[model samples]
Target: MFKALVVEKNEADGKTSAAVQELSEDQLPEAEVTVAVEYSTVNYKDGLCIGPGGGLVRKYPHVPGIDFAGTVETSADDRYKPGDKVVLTGWRVGEAHWGGYAQKARVKADWLVPLPDGLDTRQAMAVGTAGFTAMLAVMALEDHGLTTGHGPVLVTGAAGGVGSVAVAILAALGHEVAGVTGRPETEDYLKGLGASRIVPREEIAETVKRPLESETWAGCVDAVGGPMLARVLGQMKYGSSVAAVGLAGGADLPATVIPFLLRGVNLLGIDSVMQPYDNRVRAWKRIAEVLPMDKLDSMVHPATLEDLPQLGRDILKGQVKGRVVVDLNG
Candidate 1:
C-alpha cells in the first residue's frame, strides 16, 4: 500500500473532506505507466480539489495533485520504460483521474514527459504546473514578437507562483520587468525575482475610464484577469501582446475593443492543460534552459502531504506565495 491524499464525499452532508490514507496499488486506476511519485506541487486547482468538488472533481474518493515529478517504476507503453524520470502537468489527471498526491501514481503514457535535462525530480516539482504555464505565457509573448529592450514587460499577481516565475524568467532574458502586486510586503520578494519595477495592484486593478491609456507595457503575462486584465489591455504598447494565463481575480473581462482596434494589442489565451505534447516538451526544455536554477530555488515553498489540507485553503485565499512543492517522500 502507498500513502495518498484522498478526498471522500460525505453522503450525509453532501460535502467533501481530504485525508492522507494508505491505498493499495491495485486500487490505483489501471493505466499505461506506474510512477513512484517523488514530488508534487499544489496549484490553484488543487485548492479546489482538496477542499470541495469545485466542479472539477466529478467523483469522490479522489487523489488531487495537478503536477508531479517522479520515476517510472513500470510501463505498459513502449514510449516509457522503468527508471525513466517523468513529469506530468495536465490532461486532467488530478481532477478526472487518480493524480500525483500519492506516493504512487498510474497515468497514461501520453501524459508523461521525460524530465528535461539539468533538472532533478525535486526541481521539476518546483517548476510545477504554475512555472510550466508561466513559461508557456512567456513563449506566447515571444512568439508574438516580444523581445529584450522592448519597453518593460508586465507580470500581474507578481507575488504568486506563476507571476513570480514569469518575472524571474522575463528578467533573466534582459527585459525590464514590472511586477504588479497588492501586497507591499512582496515588493522585496518580487525584486529578488528580478523585477526592476513594482506596480501596485490598485494602480491597475480598477476598470479604466478611458479605452486607451498611455501605451506602457511592451508585453504582459496576466495571471489576474477581470478588471486588472481589462485595464492592462488599454495600457499595452501598440502591436504588443498580453498572454492571459489565469483568472484568479475574475473571469469576466469588462473592457473595450478599442485596444484591439486602435492599439493592435493582442490578448493571447494561454491554456497549459490542453497544450500539444510537442509544445509541452518544447516549453519544458525552454524552462530548463532559460530559467535560472538559483532563482527557481528562491521561489520554492516546501510542504508535505500532511501540510496539504491547510495549504489548500491558504492557496484559495491567496495566502500562499511562490510555488508550494510537496515532498511526497516526506
Candidate 2:
C-alpha cells in the first residue's frame, strides 16, 4: 500500500473532500510505467482538483498533482527501465486520470521524459509544471526575435509560479526583466530572482484604453489574461511577441487588433498540457541548462501530502508564493 491524497465527492450533495489515504497498487489506473513518485508541486489546477472539480478533474476519488518527478519502478515500454529518473507534466494526468499526489503513480511511458542530466527529482519538482511552461514561453519569444539588448521582457502575474520562473530564466539569459505583481511586498523577492524592475499590477491591469500604448516591453511571458493581457498587447515593442501561458486573471481578451496590425505584435499561445514529447524534452533540458539553481531554490517552499488541501486553497486564492514543492517521502 502507498499513501495518496484522495479527493472524494459526496454523492448526495456533490461536495468534495480530500484526505491522505493508504491505497493499494490495484487502485492505481493501469498504464505502461509505474513510478515511485518522489516529489510533486501544488499548482493552481491542484487547488481546483483538491476542492471543487474546476471542470478539470474528470472524476471523484482523484489524485491531483499535475506534475511530478520520480524514478521508474517498472515499465512495459522499451524506452524506460527500472530506476530510471523521469519527470511528468501535462497530458492531463492529474485532471483526466489518476495523478502524482501519491507515493506511487502509473502512467504511459510516452508521457514521461528522462529527468534532465543536471536535475534530481526534488529539484525537478521545484521547477514543476510552472517552470517548464516558463522555459517554453522563453523559447517561443526567442524564436520570434526577442534579444537581450532589446527593451525589458515583461512577466505578468510575476509573483506566481509561471511568472516567477519566467523572470528568473529571462534574467539568467541576460535580458532585462520587468515583473508585474499586485503585491508591493514581493519587489525584493522579484529582484532576488533577477528582475530588474517591478511593474505594479495597477499600472498594467487596467483595460486597454487605446489600442497603442508606447511600445515598452521587448517581449512578454503573460500568465494573466483578460484585460491585463489586452493592455500588455498595446505595450509590446514592435515586431515582438507575447507568449500567452495562463489566464489567472480571466479568460477573455479585451483588446483591438491595432497592435497586431501596425506594430507587428504577435500573441503566441503556450500550452504546457498536451505539448509534444520532443518539445517537452527540449524545455526541460533548457530549464536544466539556463535556469539558475540558486534562483530556483529561492522560489521553493516545502510541503507534504497532508498540507495539500490548504495549499490547494491557498493557490486558488493567490495566497501561495513562488512554488510549493510537496515532498511525497516527507
Candidate 3:
C-alpha cells in the first residue's frame, strides 16, 4: 500500500476532504509508467478543482495536481525505466484522470518528459505547469520577433507564477519589462524580478475609450484576460503580439479588431495542456538554459499535502504569489 492524498465527497455533509489513504497499484489507473512522485505544485487550476464547482472538476474524490517531477518507479514502456527521472505537465490527467497529489502516480509513458540535465525533481516542480506556461509565452513572443530594441515588454498579473517568470526571463534576455499588477505592495517584488516599470492594473483594465491607443509595449505576456487583454491589445506596438496564457481576470474578451487590422497586433493563445511533445521538449530545454534558479527560489513557497486544501483556495482568490511546490515525500 502507498500513501496518497485522496479527495472524497460526503454527499450528506456536502463537503470535501483531502486526506491520506493507503492505495494499491491495482487500484491506480492503467498506465505504462509509475512514478514515485517526489514533488508537485499547486496552480490556479488546482485551486478551482479543489473548490466548489470551478467548472473543472466534475467529480468528488479526485487527486488534483497538474504538474509533477519524480523518478520512474516502474515502466512497461521501452522509453523509460526504474530510476529514470521524469517530469509531467498537461495531458488533462489531473482534472480528467488521476494526478500528482500523491506519493505515486500511474500515467501513460508518452506523457512523461525526461528531466532536463540541469534540474532536479524539486526545481522541476518549482517551474511546474505555471513556469512551463510562462516559457511558452516567451517563446511565442520570440516567434513574433519581439526584442529589447523594440522597447519594453508588458507582463500582466506580474506577481503571479507565469507573470513572475516572464518578468525575469524577458529581463534576463536584455529586454525591458513593465509589470502590471493589482497589488501595490508587489511593486518592489516585481522590480526585483527585473521589471523596469510597474503599470497599475487600473491603467490597462479601464474601459477602452478608443479602438486603439498610443502604442506602449514591444510585446506582452498576459495572464489576466477580459477587459485587461482588450486594453493591452490596443496599446501594443505595431506588429507586436500578446501571448494570452490565463483568464484570471475573466473569460469574456470585450475587444475590438482595430489592433489587428490597423497595427497588426497578434493575440497568441497558449495552452500548456496537450502541447506537442517536441515543443514541450524545446520549452523545457529553453527553461533549463534561461531560468535562474535564484529567482525561481525567491518566488517559491514550500508546502505539504496537508496544506493543499487551504493553498488551493488561496490560489483561486488570487491571494497566492509565485509557486507552491508540494513536497509529497514530506
- For model 2 the local lDDT of residue 284 reads 92
lDDT of 1 at 131: 94
Q: What lDDT, from 0 to 1, does candidate 2 have?
A: 0.94
TM-score of 3: 0.97
Which residue runs does candidate 3 get wrong by more than 4 Å? Answer: 12-14
Off by over 4 Å in 2: none
TM-scores, one per candidate: 0.99, 0.99, 0.97
lDDT of 2 at 44: 93
User: Which lDDT tens digits does candidate 2 get at residues 257-309?
Assistant: 99999999999999999999999999999999999999999999999999999
